[model samples]
Target: MSRYDWNDERHALGVATMDATHREFLELARAIESGPPAEFATRFEGLVEHTRAHFAAEEALMRETACPSLREHEADHARVLGDLGRFLQSVAKGRPAMARAYIASGLSEWFDLHVATMDAQLAAHLNARQHAG
Candidate 1:
């Protein structure tokens, strides 16, 4: 299986929305990585767009729920978004080599860690809040 394939044991956090979004992210990344060369730029653009919306939704959740890690999580999201923006620029310019490598490896590795740590914490906090309420 491709590195971008979603593994429920590894990626699922028991939060329905978050889990679904993460699953979609993996699917999109996999598509971009495996799509035809001619479609690489277009697919990558779609991933970038999806990521923006995904991060925004998570940040919204953090805000509405008063998540303790809001600042740190927002910073992480900003960092990734900045990187994606730069990569998208390159891809748009017909220079996709570096971006392709990043999508193939860097993104997958980052996603795994981010989900296990940041997202896991958020999911737990959300669950606790729900139960407490």
Candidate 2:
């Protein structure tokens, strides 16, 4: 595993797509943490774009599967996306340090909670569907 990459076996969901996306997320996080003035915009924007798409995809899956706790899960997604968006905006406006701090602290916490609860719920929901079918 890379510095920012999570182990696949440890993932909340064993879904291939989600696992791949999560790996990308961690890679981007590591990239941003690496620090380079010229590449900041590219890396940061990539992170933002990937994160939005990932959240939307997950939300759509949850909605389609009729996960019982989807509302709470989506709310958490919204919270994380909102914070990330703000961090991106801050960085775009010339505050990379602040964005770095948010990723290191705020985002790390969010990821832990998201993986432990929402993501795990998603995994269970999908696993049930697979078994039922």
Candidate 3:
């Protein structure tokens, strides 16, 4: 099982701002695993909240660019959030072990998938939008 870390370059988007944000997301995930309980709670909330915001930003970019995969990208975002909700809800009940496991595995897996396919396409679309604008 791969432990989550920013060094895993698969998380990178080759877009500095987006890559930085992804790094921050990984930092939060790492902190949740290694920090104090209260700190972890804070980071976890940030993780969930930032995820929503990030998805919104990406979706907007997709729509603006008329990305062919816009619907599929949005679908993937929803599915990721649904999984995150399950993780957070479980954590809310004091199931840190389950939450951590989900974070370590599911989160990483989803991110890999998102970055490689969904986000990559969105980023390319956004780049095109930038030039076209």
Candidate 4:
């Protein structure tokens, strides 16, 4: 089985761009989780980069839409990105143990919650606006 499979129920946001970016997130997570120790840092870096871009894109959409929960959503992204940044620093120091543990345990759980809550709300708002306009 893949290390971190993205389930539709949990991962799909009903917004094409968001869903596609989320799929990439899961794929990168899976790659990092299953990659060899020697390649773990690099793989993790890729995930970090993908996440940075993903969050930025989402934030832009929220701003464009004037999402009601924009502040909260951006806060959530900031918190996670901060965590990822710290983990990246650790990986750069050749100390990927913490990062690996986070990938194997923390990340999937966090993604599930984030997608279900913040992302779902954002998607709903976006959809409503699309239908209204």
Candidate 5:
């Protein structure tokens, strides 16, 4: 199985929208990892675009809820977005080797850690707010 495959126990945060977005992210990552070489650039671009939307949605939620970790979370999103943009540039230039390596390992590792930490915190905060409301 691809490292990008979603494991609910590991990846699901119990926040409906966030969990769904995360599932989509993993699906896109898995597709890029296993897709044909000719399709790599396009698939990678799709992942980047999806990720931009995903991060924006989460950031908006953070803003709405006044999440204490908003700044740190936003910084993490920015860093990942910057990396994705750089990788997209290389892919566009027909130099996909580095980007492929990143997708295969770096990105997957980051996703696991990010979901467990920052996303989990956000999910907990949201859940608490929901229950207390």
Candidate 6:
């Protein structure tokens, strides 16, 4: 089993796109954490790429919906992306230690909290808007 399997209680948002994207995020994280050292860089890169796209998609939804927490959510995404970029740089330099640590611990914690708060709020907002429309 992978280190970070998607849990319905923790990861599901009830919003299809967001839930799917979050699942992909967890799957990528699991791959990065469990795969061979030789493949860590590649898997990590995929995760980073997936995260960029996922964030962008959610940001677009926030823009379309005029989400109240758009700025805050986007800021969180930016901070995490920047951190991931730095880790990727280190990994590229043949130093995957920091990135590995992040995958094993930091990333999982961040995801749980972020999904519970920011993404959950976003999903609720979107659902309400859709229902109202």
Q: By lDDT, who's the top model here?
A: 5
**Tens-place lDDT digits, model 5, residues 10-75:** 999999999999999999999988889899999999999999999999999999999999999999
TM-score of 4: 0.96
Evaluate model 6: give its lDDT.
0.92
Better of 3 and 4 by lDDT: 4
All candidates: CA RMSD (Å):
0.6, 1.9, 2.5, 1.0, 0.6, 1.0
Runs off by more than 4 Å, candidate 3:
131-133
Candidate 6 lDDT tens digits, 1-133: 5547888888888999889888888888987777899999999999999999999999999999899999999999999999999999999999999999999899999989999999999999999988999
**Candidate 4 lDDT, 45-116, residue by residue in tens:** 899999999999999999998999999989988998999999999989888888888998888888899899
User: Tens digits of per-residue lDDT for model 1 on 17-67?
Assistant: 999999999999998877899989989999999999999999999999999
Tell me the whole-model lDDT of each prediction, alpha carbons only: 0.93, 0.79, 0.77, 0.89, 0.95, 0.92
C-alpha lDDT (0 to 100) for residue 97 of candidate 3: 71
Reference-based lDDT, residue 19, model 1:
93
How does model 4 fare in lDDT?
Answer: 0.89
Q: Worst lDDT window (10 residues) for model 1?
A: 26-35
Pairs clashing within candidate 4: none
Question: Candidate 2, which segments miss by more than 4 Å at Cα?
Answer: 1-3
- Candidate 5: where is the Cα deviation over 4 Å? none
Winner on TM-score (2 vs 4): 4
For each candidate, how many residue pairs have backbone atoms clashing (under 3 Å)? 0, 0, 0, 0, 0, 0
Residue pairs with colliding backbones in model 5 are: none
- Score every model by TM-score: 0.98, 0.88, 0.83, 0.96, 0.98, 0.97
- Between prediction 1 and prediction 3, which has the larger TM-score? 1
Mark the regions of model 4 whose C-alpha exceeds 4 Å error after superposition: none
